[model samples]
Target chain A: MDILVCIKQVPDTKDIRLDPETNTLAREGVESIMNPFDRHALEEAVSLKEEHGGTVTALSMGPPQAETVLREALACGADNGVLISDRAFAGADTWATSYTLARAVETLGGFDLILCGKQAIDGDTAQVGPGLACRLDLPYVTCVQKTREVTADSIQVERMMDDGYDILRLPLPALLTVVKDINEPRVPSLKGKMKAKKAKIEALTAADIGAEKQFIGLAGSPTQVVNVFSPPPRGNRTMFSGTIEEQVSQLVEQLQPYL
Target chain B: MDYFLTEEQQMIVETARGITEEKIIPQRAELDEKNEFPTSILQDMAKADLFSIIVPEEFGGLGGGCLEIVLALEELARGCVGVATSFAASTLGIFPVLIAGSEELKERYLPDIAAGTKWAAFGLTESNAGSDASGIQTTAVLDGDEWVLNGTKQWITNGGEAKIYSIVALTDPSKGARGASIFVVEDGDPGFSYGKKENKMGIRSSATRELIMKDCRIPKNRLVGRRGTGFITVMKTLDVSRPGIAALGVGLGQAALDEAVPYAKQRVQFSRPIISFQAVLHILADMAIQIEAARAIVYAAARHIDSNPKNMSKASSMCKVFATDMAMKVTVDAVQVLGGYGYMKEYPVEKMMRDAKILQIYEGTNQIQRNVIGQELNKEYA
Candidate 1:
């Protein structure tokens, strides 16, 4: 089985502060990290390749700086990296992003499995994975918490729910949007890092992937960001001070009307 | 003159920084208080293949050398020198094996040590032989196919915890230093016992205990290199490893400066931030300059050891002495800059101060290092 993992580099949320005066995100000095969910996605793909002999290729669509994440993936045991970078791909919405990725997948002759994070931390939209699967005409499972089994023709997985989880079997060549519960990501090995340093990252442009100009980048996106602002603080907020019991009773008294 | 790091070297620094910042720094205080060996952190480092930085590829390593180890250690010590010491001391133990172990011994020991499945420790320091390795009283005598060892090695970093020990023992006492031989002793060997753990002033997170070898028996195959070649092997290993200690010093000095510069900026005194004061500014300047100079020399020495191993002894001692002394002064100045807060345990500088002290003492004290440099100078001038 050949596995493809789609990863993203997002601003570390821990360092992102809300500018109260401007009602906007203050991203100064924020370090970019591999999307936490995407790390689990990559870990699952690598583990699968390890258990069953196969090749794992990491795929990402971003600016030149995004190549860092791809190199990181290689260091974490990916055999190859495909960086889909182009100036024309800037300001792409989820729809265009998925279309571009799907085209890249087709350009690479597809794979037996495709894995992605359930959602990116920066944009909690959770639309690209399913959209890519739809464009490729393959079945996909979202919020996959566990992989029950994987074989040549099919894969069994547990899709997480609010209360419990649902066991589902999907045919091979399917897509998966994995949650963080899948597995612990391994640290990159030194040998893997040496290989990454020497390895030539295969770069592709929109034209190289045979993507139509009308269906890629900002020009192809349907949705636009009208405004970006932080939510205003709510009026009714209370601090529970005192011992645990007193705080609980005080909170109960305050919530009596709503209850 | 080219100070730029290779892409691979940059990656090593980045990777080590990530692990140290994310994993090691958070647990440092608690580990220090408990004086516990960083076993789990080592496991994490193993996962990152840090143990393989110095081992050869044929021995199941990344095939890196002194430069790579220096890169990783500097980043690691920046986070916590105690943790870095634990990591570096294992490499020190493996050095003798890598330098002189037979092919079969390398195959038996190097792979596991490189893979980080087992930790290794060097056993040269003793109660009576701190700087004078010629006085190492540990003795190993051949009895048929086996060698019996009886001695106590003191102040061994990773002594009780490590799985393998590279011990320097006198095989023929009459020949003095020339009679010394090194052996690889496994943890489970008969008559191998551990003494009381030493409570230390700095790098307390690393395990320091006495390795008591009472009638310890090992196969003759465990002998590293030819008989009576142990002292030279030890010297060469230290010559190669000195830069690692220098890198640790540079990292600690940098860590101290890291704390001071920010605190100086934010800390208000005399109705303004302390950084506005000329005194504070000059202190910061001196700290930065010293650390950079130390770092430059250390990097040069490490690269020289990797590329030109034959004549690195003087350069190695220069780096070790210069960097460690710089660390001691820089850390003390950092504490001074922070004033009361620096003295308090709430801040990291005090701990860094404590940690910086050991850098000057271990791996050949600054006094011994000066001796090496002076001796080299005499030989060159003569």
Candidate 2:
């Protein structure tokens, strides 16, 4: 199987701070890590390559520093890494980002399968996978919890659901957005580090990937961020400071409306 | 001085730090309190190929050197020194074989070690021989086609658990240091037994026990180097390994800093965080400076050993003495930064302080390191 994993670098949510005035995240001093879900996607892709004999390529679209995630993927067993970076690619929404990624995929030639994380943690919109699939005109599955089987022409997977899951089989040249349940990512080995240090990462810009300027960046077809804010605190909790029986009766009476 | 790590080194540091945080730190306090060897964490480390980092690739290892060892240990120590030592002592045990063993011997032993399927331990410290290695009483005698070893080795790391042991003993008592010879002893050999495990003041999670070898026999082919070169082999191994101890010290010191800095910022006193006070700020600043200095020296020393294995005694001693003493001071001050809470066992700084004390005492006490440095200085200046 020839697989491509689309990854992103996002600010670690644990250290995230809000810029209340601008209604945006304060990115300063925040460490960036590979999106948690993307890690599972890459892990699944690498395991597939190991099981069958083929190559796994990790591709990402971000600033130059985003090469760190690509290198990290290489260290985790990706056979190749490509970074799509350019100033023109800045201020991209999900539609534009997926459009540019589709162009990069074309430049690298199409793969039998494309894998992605369910969503990036920093931006929890979960749109890029489906958007990219739509742009590529390929069948796609989201919330893939397990890969049942893979062959030259088709692949089978279990799509997760609130109650359980649905098994789906898609033809080759399909896309998948994986969840954390897919697999546990392996730690990068020392030998892998040596390989990553020496490997030359392929860098592509908009022109390199043959992407049109209008469809590639902020000007691309389109959604815009109007405002971002933390939800107001909900003052819906009540505390009963009384003896056990009194507290229980008071709690039951307070919850009587919902009951 | 600012140091820029190579890409490979940075990846190594990141990988080790991840494992340390995920696997080692969470279990450290419970392991210490129970005084149990951290077998699961060590196995996790092995699975990560940490044991293979310094072994030759031909022997199924990563072909890394002293710098790689230092990088890994510094990160591991940040989580827990006992765990780091438990892992590092294996490297110490395997060095004699890598340094002087015949190809046949290396082929026999290193593959299992590099594979992390087995563990190795170094046996040199005896009851009569602490700093004075020449006073070791373990004796090895050639009988027919085998060498018989008989003596008790005290304070051995990984004593009963390790599958392989690199031990030094006297072959000719009259020649003192010249009489020493190194031998590879297997754990399951008849007459090889363990004494009671020591209850240590710190690094308690590591297993420290006595290695008792009474009438233990091995093929003469297991002898390392030659009959009289054991002392030389032992000294060179220590020289190569001292930087690793320094790296552990750096790790502990950095952990202390990691703890104190965060607590200082959030801990309120007198209507403000204590970090706002100049006294506390100076303490934090001093801690950072000291740790950085120690780290720089330890990294430099490790690189020095990697590049120039010869003439590293003085540099090794310098780094070991400086870094370990610095760790002791830094951890103590970290406790002071938190004041009364720091003294409490519930917080981590107290455990860090306990861990820091052993760095100065083991791997050749800081006093012995200074003596080695002074002796080298006399030779160089004269």
Candidate 3:
């Protein structure tokens, strides 16, 4: 089985700053880390590969610098890594991003499984994995909390819901969007690190993957950010001091006229 | 310039750091307060093959170089100095055997120690021979096929818990340092027992006890290196071990600085962040400079040992003296930066300060290191 984990490099949320002038993210010098959710997805993929005896390949679509995330994934025991990077892919909404990824997957030939985080922290748009599956015409599962079983033919996963979880068994060549509750990521071993350092990340462009020219970059994106701004300062709030009972009585008296 | 660590070294550091952060740091304070041996910490470290960092691969060891061991020690010490001390002492204890032991001895002992099933310790310092190692009075008498030993070793790290001990005993009464011979003393030897555990000011989680040997008997084959060469062997081992201690200091200091930077940025004084003030920034800048310099020197010394093992006594001692003292000062400043909060036990800098003090004292005191440096310089001139 060949397991493919799709990950993203996002600005660390803790380190993020906003540019008030342009109402855009200030990315300069902001440290970028592997998406926290994607780490769990990568861990799941690696664990499956370790237990089932297969190759784990990490795939990422971003700017050229995104290769660092792939290297990090490789360091965490991925057997191989691929970078799908191109300027034409910039400003892509979830729809275009998924289409671009599906094309890249097609170019990679056959894969037994595909895994991704439920969402990217920067965008918080949780549509790429399912949209990619739809485009590729494969079975898809979202918010997987645990993997009950995995075989060459099929996989059993526990999908998380608001109130409970559902265990679903899907055939191979399936796609999954995982939550952070799956498994702890393994630290890179000495051998794994050396391999990662030397491993050549095969870079693929939209043209390389045979992406339709119209379905790339801003031209392909349907939604646009018209404006982004911080919320305005709140009005002064009244204070209710003293004992809880006295405060409640005073508040009721004060509000009697409005009632 | 090979700026990157070797693949093996990087992996060891990564694995050791992960294990330390995940398993060791969370329990550090509790273990210290209880004076526990951190059995689970050792078990986890062993599971990660940390014990094999310096062991030859042929003997089931990691075959890692000194720099690799120092790197791993730095990460491990960042979590808990006591656990790091225990782990480092085990590596130190096994070095004499790994370097000079016969095939039979290495085969019999290295596997278990490397595998983490058995812990090893080096016993050299006596109550009277702290810096002056030649003053040791422990006697080893040849009795046909066995050697009978009698000695009391003080402040032995990992003392009571070690399964195997590399002991130095005087084989000839008149030859002073030249007469000292190294021997492997196994636990449960009829006359070998441990004395009281020392109540330490810091690194209390590490087991430090007196090693008592009253007419202990060991096979003649257990003699490490050749007779009358134990002093040199011990010195060589210290040359390797001191860098490890320096690395520990680096780790503690790094942790302190790491914690302090964020804290200074967040902690407000005079209606503004302390870090915004020039005075605080200068302190942080100085600390960063010292830490980087000390780490560079330590790594250079470790690499010198790995690349050229002939003679590195001066370099090793220099690293030990500089790195350890730098760590002590850096940790103290880290505490000062935190102010009242830093003085509390809840803050890590207090513990780091305490831990850093021992590094300066142990692995040869800064004063003793200077003495070694002076003597080595004289030898060059003479």
Give candidate 3 regions above 4 Å deviation.
A19-22, A136-140, A149-173, A207-210, A214-216, A232-259, B1-80, B103-199, B204-223, B258-311, B377-382
A best-first ranking of the candidates according to their DockQ comes to 1, 2, 3
Give the per-residue lDDT digits (tens) of candidate 3, residues A1-259. 7988999999999987889898889999999999988999888888888788889889999999999989888877788899998889988899899999999999997899999999999989899989999999999999999998877799999999999999999998899999988876655555455667899999998889999878877889898898987788999878999999999998999899999
How do all models score by TM-score?
0.87, 0.82, 0.78
lDDT of 2 at A256: 100
- DockQ of all candidate complexes: 0.53, 0.34, 0.23
- Local accuracy of candidate 1 as per-residue lDDT tens digits, A1-259: 8999999988899887766666555766888889999999999999899899899999999988888999999999999999999889987899999999999999997599999999999889999999999999999999999998888999999999999999999999999999988887777877788788789999999989999998888899999776777668889777998899999999899989998
True-structure lDDT of candidate 2: 0.92
Chain B TM-score for candidate 1 = 0.99
Candidate 1: stretches off by over 4 Å: A11-33, A85-90, A106-112, A133-174, A179-184, A203-215, A230-259, B307-311, B377-382
List, residue by residue over B71-153, the lDDT tens digit for candidate 3. 99999988888889999999999999987888999999999987889999999999999889999999999999999999899
lDDT of 3 at A53: 85
Clashing pairs in 3: A190-B11
Q: Evaluate residue B295 in candidate 3 and report its C-alpha lDDT on the 0 to 100 scale.
A: 90
lDDT of 1 at A150: 85
Q: B303, model 2: CA deviation in Å?
A: 5.2
